[model samples]
Target: MNKKILGLVVSPGEAEKKVNTLIDMIPCALKEVSQNTEEWQVQTIVDSLTGSAESINEIFQKINAHTKKNAWDVTIGITDLPIFHEGKVVNADINEKNDVILISLPSLGWKLKKNVIKQLIIKMALTISESDNDSNNKRSPSFINIFPRNYKSVRLKIKETDSFHTRFILGSKIKGYMRILTGMTFINNPLNMLQTLSGVLAIGFTTGAFCMAFTTMWQLSYLFNGWRLLLASVSSILGMLAWITVSHNLWEVPSKKNRKKFRKLYNLTTLSTLMSSILIFYFILFLLFLLLSVTLLPPSFLGQTLGIKEGIGFTRYLDMHGLLLL
Candidate 1:
């Protein structure tokens, strides 16, 4: 018997872009799945069918009836509306006997990356067809035991969830690359790009302020003792920590108290990245200054500007504090 897969887009005209993407990617995905079975003939048709259904079960039933009437062996329905199961957001849901799979596009996040969404849809397709057995076997036996008998029904929550890590190796380099590509693509959208630019500017401003404080302390060291510079450095770091903590709390979800730990981790990572970036920026600036000074400035001019004493050598002056300016 020939296998037929029907892809449907149950969304309004506003979501036609997503529908177009699904139409283009689903065939390639099914082809990948059917590599071992040459007898299977896969064909796809896409159309806009907006439904007023709210719950996953209702949406599934609606799609099931439609698929049955159309004589589609397997139906994959994509919708812009949010879907929920057990009071939690779900990316996709499936019914085995009904041979129908419903994908809730909104659950994939607001910043849509075509490749990520396509992969997710493909994953759902494979899951529904039971062709994900090889991948499933890689997971822990305890996890595999939780699936319903014969994989009759499955629900997935793709965004802002810890479940994906449990099912797949979360640290894969390929996965990292995919995420980076997705982020790059997502930022192509005007709103997402603006948000990214805002984040960069925020980080840049904070790092610049911290670097300026360090530079100020370094200048003060020329007049005062080194201990004063050390104290200032400690204070600057404390201020950065305070700012991170405050900003994190302000942006965090108030209802998720457990996120406090994750927020700390995020803050620590951000702090390290910020400090390292500032240090690198300072080093680049110092290099440029030194190059210009060596190529353009006269020795006497350098000596005077660098505060070289009558007997102190230019090299010695550079060694003492010039490199420290970086």
Candidate 2:
């Protein structure tokens, strides 16, 4: 299939003025071509954004003339713009295949940038794609359903099948949290803080479980010397604690201001979590290494040792318990 070219028609003037000109022209153009008029039979106006009927006619004439020379046909259609009937506006939906324009013609009160027109055409055509899929009624594998699905285009269709559950799970929980913290109670089934808490717990539990497994492995490898495994266990516990503290702080922030505050705080929180975990782990490791050195080294080395072996053992026992039970 050929890739689509989205185009915009800016009407050769300042963007704001052109947009305003289009907005003013729409209702006026509709007025001239009402059911009482001879052009009433026309179901839609293909090109019209400016508030001028003549300009619209001229555009059609130009298209007709072009078709005669190039032997190429271009179909066009127009629809009502409900939101920006008259306003300073930015059409975020405008893109290469979605064109938007401003016009002054009475008949063609508004125009789309050529690309906006193309997207509208494509979106209309996709209705048939849905019907085709409905006829087949095929179901994808479970793995394919793991990611998000938006039936807008072929690109999205492919991506939906390719992405992993990790993304979906993360996104779903985030969206759920947004709904909950915002007090968006209008939703019949809003995501609650409880669910967000559950997701965080699940993540912490998984981390803790992995740490326990690693500790077990270290216990096997070093035999009597489990300082390395103890270190990992302590780090994991600290990481979980930091994660929880930050997440709780985030959850407490009111949603109205959270959007603005989050960008800065989120980075800090993430960095703090990493640094805190690393520092805690290494600090423990240093203490453990010193205590072990006291036993392994000569009597002169005992003065250099900072931690007692009893303290290291007690801390490891506590870290391991906290991690596994978390």
Candidate 3:
């Protein structure tokens, strides 16, 4: 029988782009690995994330139904949504009977994302093609290496028969925390702060530019030691982060259905995202403050305010203290 594969992408942007690109490569790679004589065909379906899939089993059922309706032997689903199995963030799900692969894009995280996903797809394709079995024999060594050495790809029997459904997840909680943190941060996208925080940046730069002309500001910047400046920067960033989180109501309030640990992860991801964005904001503001201070602050005035003689001492003081204060 001719084997047909369907690539279903459930999210826009990176998920759609990467999965579509990888779809073109699947046929060729499958032929090389499985070496089947039957004609190989791949079809792609682009769809928005399904909000109805509240559980992994629900997602599996949806993918399975789609695959069966399309008459595809195998369907590979890539989604940006976070999927959980047995209280852990499920990175990938494979149903042996349905021949469907569901991947949680965020669970893969941002680091080495494309490579990790590509490897997972190829490995799963090979597995479903019957390259290996439920025994200890004939294993793909490279597949095990995709996750960290400490990580385990646990397989559980979904039926009374010999077939097994496998899930790739971070077994260790610490590693899981790091993985979810980076993944959620990637999804939140720190770079978008450039556009979203335009008003905040404008007001801050405007006020700072005006402050640069004042001798009090100059003297304060000069008086502030390294530790004091560092403390100010930290406090400023934290304050901004706190304000944004509270004002926008971004904090995830746990519900009765929410898992305790997962809820913590959710809140942590939010905090991490906010912290990254605020740091970026602070960095840009620091550059603006530095430019205004150096260009507008005069050597004579700054030297007198700083109580340092003109020339090298004044220049050194000004340059060293150019660091932004709170």
Candidate 4:
């Protein structure tokens, strides 16, 4: 029987054609090496039993045991395994004693001498969702990808490697296998739940401001013949000003930490505005709208229409003046 090399991939879901492509590339890459090394040939290729880490390990263990007892000189590499814990992708490496698993690529054959590379392809070769019917191979998703969210990763470092922070592979060493995880998962910090909550709040405040402005200017004052139009105008102006000065200002900051803090503050302000009695809020909004209009409306028209210098009506002004005396 020909000696076989097994490349195992653990993924989020069903195996796709991209996995097959990666397998095809392996043999071509390894053949270019000097003849002195083991004249390896890829015999049988297998997709593992399941999408779990334990399944991957079981398969590798079985292969190792079978190969070892037979002394078949078979080489096996396991990669593209997704290990998801918590909400982030953790990088773990497979090593055994001092022997490292080789990432057998013809280009980086130097690094493959003693390192095991957890085969990861960031770009996908093909991914077709249900709704999409683009059968052409060009439209497919990546052939090589780890996973979407924070999932599993392989983390390993060589002492003399220049880019220690970047991903690399090592060859098998010593006897048994060793797994290493540095406890780091995401490249960027994880988003807080509170950040999303704040966005919901800001949206509510802006919407209320617009609705109140419209009601005060066009509906409430004309329907009731109310003196509260001035008040409505004032409230509208204040709300708009508050949105621009306080709410808008707070949300635009670059730092996620600071934006989160401001978002919480604005959320509270919006809630308090909404909690007020509906009738009272309407009146307040009307006053703001009227106040803003007066800045643009003519004093002459105010006097002709309402018998006042500004937009205030004379009877209401005198009544307020007389009440102050009483």
Candidate 5:
């Protein structure tokens, strides 16, 4: 019996995480998926493949080169970058001849990508094993993947079988857009970015303290209802997102190299990532202020300023002061 080696080349961050977690299960999975008697050995490596926006052909070639260099029977390249073909997002690219597969992590969305990847890997193995379609080999969608929002929006039904490769494309435009956006946001990891920026944290804390110290600030918080405060919070977040977008020039302008749709998608991704970070920051600030308002400030002092005669619980105090202070 011949032994086959499988190499996984994954994008550096979250893409790597998704694939690495499968290292133990994949070889055993391939054994079960493959009808052949060969034992499978799986190895993993990290690579970004290419930084270019248009990297489909480049990725395919890189997968081949990596396989040759590493001497593996099959190579699967997982990238966080969105793969676009014919104005649509591509979920997977499989070259049966070369025994190579390229998976777009962002197309697989955030939560259920790990399981989806496992299923795809098994299916791709089955595809590579067959020269023609077998009706009995039809794979059903996992129950976990039925929900588009919670799982992936990438449906594996559309297969473009060709001399070179088979493509799995995302079905709906709206679902594809959202899946790519959320996946991109997940890969970019804005909350981690927020944690590293000391200046932002310092400014946020200082401003929060300044607002909390003022009696007038508390009165203003008292005057504004929850709806008004929520509006203000949303407005401030939007303003910050806009400012960051313009100031950093994160918006992708169309060029000879990149298409208008890609630029639009990328710009939306940048905003989404930034908005996630800012919203997380806002929530953390609210929680922190809520904790402080209950512990540090006296209920009697708050009621006197708000002109409330009777007993109001800490929830009301938190609702009025905590987020408004931020």
Candidate 6:
């Protein structure tokens, strides 16, 4: 079979680098699809179209005219402008004729923009070239829809063909990390950053609290010999973990009834656990302060403030030798 050459038109000269990158990646993306389906050949001819069109329809019409004039099998237009379908922003739009695909860079957003565009462009190319019309491939509502918010749903179902599975798998593997790094760095949207930071802080606080409780138990071991202190510390940490799990489930679970019930229980348990941990931590600190006062404070001050005789040494109060025994 002869290679089917596709023309890629880029308007608004500023997007040349991004468009060129997509053009370079398309061949690699289509490699599996082409090999599996009777040696279908695909090539891209990149062109820079000057001037701008007022609407997405105008952009399509202009590109369509060029594709018809050049007798190209397919044409894709890459533009920086935002494109909309039925009032909602779309990352890319494919005409039913399958001869033209228009990509709106702004709709892909700043985070993972290039990778997403590459995936979308490749999907479009393979989709247009697929020969099996009987295969029930549900078209995504929008190009952004192709990149589902849930990572598990990132699979692109193109005619249920095994070769196309590679495309979806490759795209899904990197998407999760890309989104995380993008949220941290490139996008820098305040809400996203705050949400991510809050999650980190929640986990950090839980771990820190557990460690502090254990440290408190160890320190208190000098005063108490029984397993009661150890049991209490372990119980407190377990309580904290339970509260965290409930709260996390409350936030993640979609069922309204379960969420409502969990929300109330989470709030009560979280408050109780938090208060207990704070009190325990503060008691530990107070003990440390008392130990410091006894070990370091002058006998004169101790006699005046603690009402102790001047002859008594600080070690007499804390029994430093006993503490060292542990």
Ten-residue segment with the worst summed lDDT in candidate 5?
Answer: 152-161
Per-residue alpha-carbon lDDT of candidate 1 for residues 12-99, written as tens digits (9 for 90 to 100): 4434565575665567666766684523233444444444424345555567667777776557776755444433344455554454
Give residue 125's lDDT in candidate 6 (0 to 100).
63
Best by lDDT: 5
How does each model score on lDDT?
0.46, 0.31, 0.67, 0.32, 0.71, 0.48
**Candidate 1 whole-model C-alpha lDDT, 0 to 1:** 0.46
Q: Sort every candidate by lDDT, greatest first.
A: 5, 3, 6, 1, 4, 2
TM-score-wise, the better of 2 and 4 is 4
Question: In candidate 4, what are the lDDT values of residues 1-326, reduced to their tens digit?
Answer: 22234333332221223344455554444433222232334333343423233223443444444445444332333333332222222233232221112211211211222112223321110011111224442322221232222222334443432222212222231110112221011101112222433554355445544543342322322343334544554575467446544754533434433344334433433333332322243344335444444454444553445444455454433322222111
Tell me the spans in candidate 1 whose CA falls farther than 4 Å from its real position.
Answer: 1-3, 22-25, 36-53, 131-326
TM-score of each: 0.38, 0.19, 0.81, 0.25, 0.82, 0.40
User: Between prediction 2 and prediction 3, which has the larger lDDT?
Assistant: 3
lDDT, candidate 3, 190-274, per-residue tens: 8776688989888878876766666676667666776777776778778888899899998878786666666777788889887
Per-residue alpha-carbon lDDT of candidate 6 for residues 1-326, written as tens digits (9 for 90 to 100): 44566677775444566566666566656666567443333344445443342244556667778788877666777775543322334445566543477765444444446776666766676666552243565443234455556322132323312112211111333443333223223222223323434554455444533443333432443355435544555575566556655766523344534344324433443344344444444344436544544555455654454444554464433432222222
**Runs in model 4 with CA error above 4 Å?**
1-16, 22-24, 35-38, 47-81, 84-92, 95-326
Which residue runs does candidate 6 get wrong by more than 4 Å?
12-14, 36-54, 131-326
Candidate 5 segments exceeding 4 Å error: 51-55, 130-162, 197-199, 313-316, 322-326
Pairs in steric clash, model 5 = none
> What is the Cα-based TM-score of model 5?
0.82
Which structure is stronger by TM-score: 1 or 6? Answer: 6
Error of 4 at 125 (Å): 22
Please, what are the lDDT tens digits per residue for candidate 2 over residues 1-326?
A: 22221112222222323333444333334334332231111112233233322113333333334334433222222312111111211111111111122222111112334333333333322322223336552212222221123211111111212321111111233332332222112111122333444554456445544554443522333233346556765676676656766766633444543333333334343444344444444344445443543444343322224233433434444333433432
Residue-level error in angstroms, candidate 3, position 41: 4.1
Superior by TM-score: candidate 2 or candidate 6? 6
Q: Can you write out model 5's per-residue Cα lDDT over 270-322, one digit (the tens) per residue? A: 88888888878777777766776677678887787678888556667666554
Per-residue lDDT, model 6, residue 143, is: 41
Error of 2 at 184 (Å): 32
